[model samples]
Every structure is written in C-alpha cells, then in structure tokens.
Target: MGTSLLTNSSAMTALQTLSMTNKKLDMTQNRIATGQRVSTASDNAAYWSIATTMRSDNKALGAVQDALGLGAATIDTMYTGLNGTVEVVSEIKAKLTAARTPGVDRGKIQSEITELQKQLKNTGDSAVFNGENWISVDSNSTSYNSTKSVVSSFSRAGGVVQIDTVTVDLEAIKLYDKKADATPLTNVVTGASAGTLVAVAGNITVQVGTGATVNVATTTTSTLDSIAKDIMKLGIDGLTVAVGGGQLQFANRASVNGAPAGVTIVLNGGLTAPAALATAPATETGKGILDKSYDAYNGTAWEVFSVANIDISKLTDNAADLAKLETYIAGVDDALGSITNAATNLGAIKNRIGLQQDFVKALVDSLDRGVGQLVDADMNAESTRLQALQTQQQLGIQALSIANGASQSILSLFRG
Candidate 1:
C-alpha cells in the first residue's frame, strides 16, 4: 500500500497484530495465575452462576452435617441412659423374685431395689446433651415438644431451597414425665355384668378419701348410673363417679388437697362382686419409673401399685402376698421392655444419622467436582496456551520493528 510518514500502512498493520497478541497473552497469563477458566460473570455467566449457587448449597450442606452430628450425639446419650436403666430394672425384677421365697428378708431386698431405682433416676436425669434431655422431661412444660427434629439435608429444586429433617418422637421413648397437677386414685370395675348390682340381701359400703362410708342396701335394684349418683349425693370430698361401657369408674382426687388416699369398697354377704375390680391409682408423677397402673388384690381388697412404689417388704408365703409379688414382677418386666424398646429405637436413629452423614459428605464432594468442572482451569492446557501466546507476542514485536524500518527506507530514497 501507500507509504506516508503520517499513516504508514505496513506499520499500522504490524502494530494492530502486536496489540491483539499482547491482549491474548494477558488473558492466558490471567487464567494460569488464577487457575480458573471462568472466574467471573464476564467470562461465562451461566456457568459461573451455576458454580456459585452450587458452592452456596455446599455450605448449607455442611451446616446440615453439623446438625446431624449434634443429633447423633444426643441419641447416643439417650441410648446410654436407657441401656443402664434396663440393667437396673432387671436387677429390681430379680430382687422381687427372690423376695417370693417363703420367709426371705424382703426388707433387705427392698433396700437393694430402692438403690437400683435411684440409679435409674440418676441415669435418666443425667442423660443430657446440648441442654436437651429426652429421657427425663416435664410433659407439662410450655416449651415441651414431643417430636424432636434433626436437620438431615439441604436441597434445591427449581431455584427453591428446602431443608429436610429426621424426627424422633420423645413421647414413645421418654422414661419419666413430671406433671403440673397430681393424678388421683382411680378404681375401674369392668365386665359383662359390671354395670349391674344384682338384687340381694346385704349392704355395700363405699369409702373414698377419708370420707365417711356410705351404706346402700344391696336389695335395691340399681344400674351403674344410680350407684354413681348415690355416691356423688353423699358430697364426699374430692370424689367423682362415672359409668360407661359396662364399667363403673370411681376417682378420688384427694392428692390435689395435699393428701393422696385410696378407695375401699366392702361387699357384705350374698352380693356377687363385679367381674373385675382394678383398684389402681391412675398414672401420676413420682408413682413409677413408667406411667402404668398395676393391680394387687389381697382377698377382700385390691390395691394399686407400680414398679417404683411396690411394697415387697410386706410380702410373705401367703397366697395373697405371693400374688402381689407376682404383680410387682410383671410391672417391672413391663418397664424393662419399654426401656429396651427405647434403646433399640435410639440405635436405629444413630445408624440413620451415620448413613446420612456419609451421604452428605459424598454430596458435598460431588458438588465440588461439579463446580470445578464449570470454573477450574486445566493447568496443562493453560500452560501450553501461555507458551504459544508468548511466542506469538515475540513474533508480532519483530514484525512491527520490520514495518517501522520501511519508513527509514522511504527517507533514504528521498535523499538519493
């Protein structure tokens, strides 16, 4: 083309090529330095956005892993306590069995049992982690929640994020629950003929909560409702009577008055007793290791007892005391079964948390790989490109120098 001092075409072409080469070399060096192909939105917006979001999600998954770890620790604590309680309850059962011997020193056996019961309480109370105690709790507390939730996973779908949780029902596994109000003594009489008092020639005496006994002639033909009404008519303090489902329920709520008492029903001659009279107080706090009522009938009377309050000290070789001891053994066995089941459940939860921990770690690794694929620079490729660009930049500089020399040649021609 035309050679002019102000606009030399060859020099302009060489300078443009060198400038382009320098730009490419700078870009290659940046990739090598940062070790990323798409470090910013300007490089590759879609991929960068995806990688950024995935990184954020991975952080949330890390938090979920932490939560799972905390939950596992809590479960471990509960399981440890429950397992110890099972051993203590088993020992108590053995003592009750030993007490069944004809004239064994039951008072000494009871002393051992009392120590074991204390151990159970201590275990339940101390099984706490992170201020959370599942074994021993107050169900009546305002902040109490029966279901405990543990964060297990964080997921994103269609740009929406959600956290998943694993739940444990404390109600099914708790060993003790303190109540705000005292539970009363209850007697339930149930059978096909429970609601009917057959006409006979005797008197029935009912005494409730230190109140005066009420006498009602057995000859009076009465339904369960009439009997309940008659008992309520006496204005016995803290007493309630209700009849339903072929059953007569009598409750003495004297515990609310600071004195807990039992109910006694005496049947005088010729009157057939109800089919079954379960003389057990309703489940109450401080009554037992487990909230269940057990019946111990001593010929003329049925008494209520529990694993924690059973009086094996009074047991003897007599049939009545033997029967009572049998009931105590059965109640203790039930409590043991409950504790074992709770431990099993806690173990299952621990295993599930372990599995989830593994899965979350795997998921975090996968996300890292995915983000790396989108943004990370291949060092080998970047280094090779860097070498090639440096070579091109040197060649472009030489070509520009040659083009500028053409202007010198033009000056020589003018001088000639």
Candidate 2:
C-alpha cells in the first residue's frame, strides 16, 4: 500500500498492534492480581459457576461439621453418665448380696444403698449437654422425642442439594422417666394376693404373733380351704385365715397393750408361707415400705424393679424376706445390663461420628483442590506471561513511534 499524508498506514498498523498488546498485558496482570484464571463469568463461565456452587456447598458442610461436634458431645455426656450409674448400681448389688447373710445389720446396708440410689439419680439428671439429657426425661413433656437426630452431611447431585443425619433412640438409653403414669412406690413388691402359693407335702407349723405354735397336717388330698380352717381353729387373738382364689390369706386385727402389734407368721417343715402372711404388718416393723412393688423403665417391657427404690432395711432372715432380697438384686442386675448396652451403643456412635468428622475434613480438602484446579491461577505461569506481555507492549510502542516518524520524512520533502 502507498503512503498517504492523512492515513499514515504504517503508523495505523503499529497502533493497532500496540493496542492489542496492551489489552493482553492488562489481562495477564488481572490474573496475577486475582490469583484466579476464571474470576468471573467473562473469564470462564462454566468453571466460575461450578466453583461458586461448590463454595456454597462447602459452607453447608461446615455447618454439618458443627452439628456433628455437638452430637458427639451429647453422646459423650450420656456415656459418662451411664458409666457412673453402672458403678453405683454395682455397689448396690454388692450391698444387697451382703444383706443376704444372716445377722447382718440390713439397716446399715440399706443406708449405703440409699446413697448409691441418690447417686444414680444425680448421674441421670446431670448427664446433659447443650440443654439435652438422654438419661432422664419426662415422657409426658410435649417436646419429648424418643429419637434424636444429628446432622451428618450435606450433599449435592444433579443440581439438587440434600442433608444427611444420624439418629439415636433415646428410649433405649433413658434410665428414668418422670411420667405421671409411672409405677408408684406402692407397687415395689408383689402384692399379697400375688404371692407364691403354699403347696407342701408335709405338716406345717404356723405361729402368728405370740400365740403358741400350731401344727396343720397336710395330705395330698388336703385342700387349701381345709388347711385354712385348721389354722383358724387355733383361736389366736386377732388372727384371721381365709382361702381366696385357692390362696390362703392371713390377717392380725388385734393390737397389744394400747400399742399396735405386728403379725409374724413363721412356718416350718419346708412349707412355703403365703405371701399374705409375709405382708408388711400394720405396725410396719420387720417390713420395708420399698418391698411392696417397684417397676423400672416406667412399666416398659423390661418391667424390672427400680434400683432406686430397693430397701432391705426391715427385711429379716426368713425365707420370704430373703426371696424378696434376691428379687431386688436381680432387678439391679437387669438395670446394670441395660445401662451397659446403652453405653456400648453410645460409644459406637461416638466412633462413627469421629470417622465421619475425618471423612468430612478430607472431603472438604478434596473440594478445595477441585475448585482450585477449575478456577485458580498458576502464579508461576501467570508471572512469566505478565513479563512477556509487558515486553511485547513496549516493543509495540516503539514500533508505533518508528512508524509515526516516517511522516517526518514526508514533511522534510515538502519543506525542500
């Protein structure tokens, strides 16, 4: 192309090259400054969008991690409480076992047991974290929930987001419930009507109060009514024996010397005395109030007696009282087993939460690396490119200056 005074074609070409070089230099500088190859939709639309969404999901995962932490703390609290309760219940069991020996001061043993029971209650009540207590609960509360859920993870797939959770059954782990319908103290021991029947193959000696010993002969053909009639023939003051539902019932209705006198029925010759005769007498001596009937778990299917209500203070060395003591021990054992199972389950959950925490951390790191690969700039490469583009911009400016100087040559010709 021929040169023209107005056009200056060579200068125009150099000017265009310089402008393009400056734009490229500006872009390299921006990449270095932002540390991102795709900082915006204009840089790389698809990658920027993906990184934005991933960042949002990472925030959600962070919240899930917090939830997991809270859940772990709650479980740890419950486990600690259960472990302490196990120790206390074990102590109570030992005390009850010791009380089984004849001539042992059961009142002293019962005092120890009472303190242990208080400890159990305290442990249950205090096993709380973040205002949550799984050990002791009021089932009648409007907000009570047997199942507790903990947020575990946040996930996204095909543009859809979801949250995952772990759940625990509080009912299985709960030691006590304060529901109004719970079994009362009166039901701690089996009722008199519910006592074991007197079925023996020999004559049985019965002594009620201070009355003389009476022998009631029993044959295979002897009916409970006939036996009861023979005991009634003793004419003991304030003693009444009757047969009801094939079970013998005994009552002492008389007081002695202006004071209430208790009835004591002693049977020999391997004849099991009716539970009615063993019932806590009106005088309330030689009988513990807690020996009535107590149910743990608030009448759940387990139906074991409450360790907290076990009382051997007034229990004698008689067969019936000893038998009642045995029942108390069994109930405590059952409660211990249940608490142990709950602790095991809580431990497993704690382990799982730890594993999940590790997994979440790893997953978050992986996500960071992935987003980095998609959008983050390589500083080494960007710096090198920036240097090269700056050199190119300088060179383009020089070329444009040289091209514009060609117009000076044309001006010289005109002056000549």
Clashing pairs in 1: none
Candidate number achieving the greatest lDDT relative to the actual structure: 1
Tens-place lDDT per residue, model 2, 355-385, is 9999998999999999999999899999999
Go through the candidates in order and give each one's C-alpha lDDT.
0.73, 0.69
In TM-score terms, candidate 2 sits at 0.73
Displacement of the residue 156 alpha carbon in candidate 1, Å: 1.3
TM-score of each: 0.75, 0.73
Candidate 2 local lDDT, residue 410: 75
Candidate whose TM-score is highest: 1
